[model samples]
Target: MENPITRPRSVERLVAGQATSDGAGVKLTRVLTQDLQRRLDPFLMLDAFRNENPEDYIGGFPNHPHRGFETVTYMIAGRMRHRDSAGNEGLLGPGGAQWMTAGSGLIHSELPEQEEGLMEGFQLWLNLPAKAKMCAPGYRDIPPPAIPEYVDGAGVRVRVIAGDSGGVAGAVRRPDTEPLFLDLHLPAGAGFGQALPAGHNAFLYVYRGSVIVRGAPVADRHMAILGNDGDGVVLQADGDSRVLLVAGRPLQEPIVQYGPFVMNTAEQIHQAVRDYQAGKFAAAAVQAF
Candidate 1:
């Protein structure tokens, strides 16, 4: 049994979320640094968009380019239409996901086609290593049931998307992404302790309600960063709170980010655009949708 971690002595940065839109009218919530320059090393950003009115999110993300990173989309409440320049197209309904590794390069678009006039989901960005920066692009569209779910004796529910924690291997893959993904739910006024891997950079994003992390008290949409010293994290609920805990080892690499591309060097960004403009991997577009 993991012992309860005391109050975090080191303070965590309470980053504020921002609001933006892509694909014309698709609303989004940015959970990390407002400027891409300040984005975390291994993780770039997390965007959450939940809309019930079709007019709010139906426009979706238009044709765009990405390289040297992976785009993960998880739909919770509604449906989304996915078409990529790589010629992979599908309808990701509720509890479905589209994990795309835009290794070398890829062009894609996401359109929301909610059946009940609602569109809700998230898109997370993960950095890649220099060696795999130019690898071929690929994708995995996993449905709701494909993800692992675990229920604790204390009425805590967790959906594992990646990595292992709480006896759940969310999504199994060879040398899985270092990060652990969990959709956590805690009953009102309940408290729980999460044993974390030492030295792993981690954070919690509140989606539906407020939570008291280390007694700081965070509300929905706010991201709470955790220190690397502790082995487990403590979370206490103010109400029936729902949150997403994403933890991973820091890449500690130089990040050069542009609008849709994340590379290591500025020159790499320049070359990435040049390669795309020159049709270096133009055929990648054919398979994305």
Candidate 2:
């Protein structure tokens, strides 16, 4: 029997994401940093946006370019219209997800599909290794029905987006960074636990209600960095808690970032900008919807 007291994993650090805006005046919270606090390698940034006021998010993300990395957009509520220069288009509704690998380069935009109501979602940036950074760009869109869900007798629910839980797997497959992305909902007085990949960098973001991670308390809107020694994660709901758990293997490579471009060297960063201006990025704009 597994000892409930020995959770192996515990909160090592906690950070309250800073307030920031990106992509044509869209408001959101920035969870990861590009500076010293960048303990979550391979995983670059996490932007969480939730607003009841339509004016706060109607602007949405305008046309933008990205390269040498991948972006995962998971929608919890509301609808977003995505259009890429590659001629790909889709309406991402509630509980949908889009994983875009901007290998080489790509231009895309995510605009609000509606004019009013609440909009809540998360956009996570995953770094590509030096070798795979310039690979062919591709994308995968997973609708709400396509994503698998699991529920225990205790009323604890889990939605797997990019990993496996209790033998049920997520929709995202073979990403450059082997990622485990899970949405967990624990009802009042409920507890949840799961085994994590060994040696993976993991963290928990509590977005609703309060919870206990390992032996520490985590409130809403806060991120908890877990120690690497843990082989699994444990949580207990203080109320009706909701959280997102993400883990990935660190690349441990040089990361040179400039705007939407992420590369290993400064020279590569400048070349990306020059290539975009020279229309070289248009190669990714294939006429495929």
What tens-digit string does per-residue lDDT give for candidate 1 at 1-289?
1225654423277766888777777778787653633334477888888887777786778888889888888887877777777778888988777788898898888866654566777888888878778877888888888888877766777788887766667673423238777788888877766777666677888888888877688888788887676677878789999888877666777888888888989999999989889976658732232
User: How well is each residue in 150-217 modelled by candidate 2, as lDDT tens digits?
Assistant: 88767888898987876788887555468889898889878887787777889989999988987799
Best candidate, lDDT: 2
Q: Evaluate all candidate structures by whole-model CA lDDT and list the values in order.
A: 0.76, 0.84
Clashes of 2: 0
TM-score of each: 0.90, 0.94
**Which regions in candidate 1 have their CA more than 4 angstroms from the true location?**
1-11, 34-39, 172-177, 285-289
Stretches of candidate 2 exceeding 4 Å from the true structure = 1-6, 36-38, 285-289
**Distance from true location, Cα of 220 in model 1, Å:** 1.5
State how far residue 94 of model 1 sits from its true place (Å): 1.5
Measured with C-alpha atoms, the lDDT of residue 266 in candidate 2 is 99
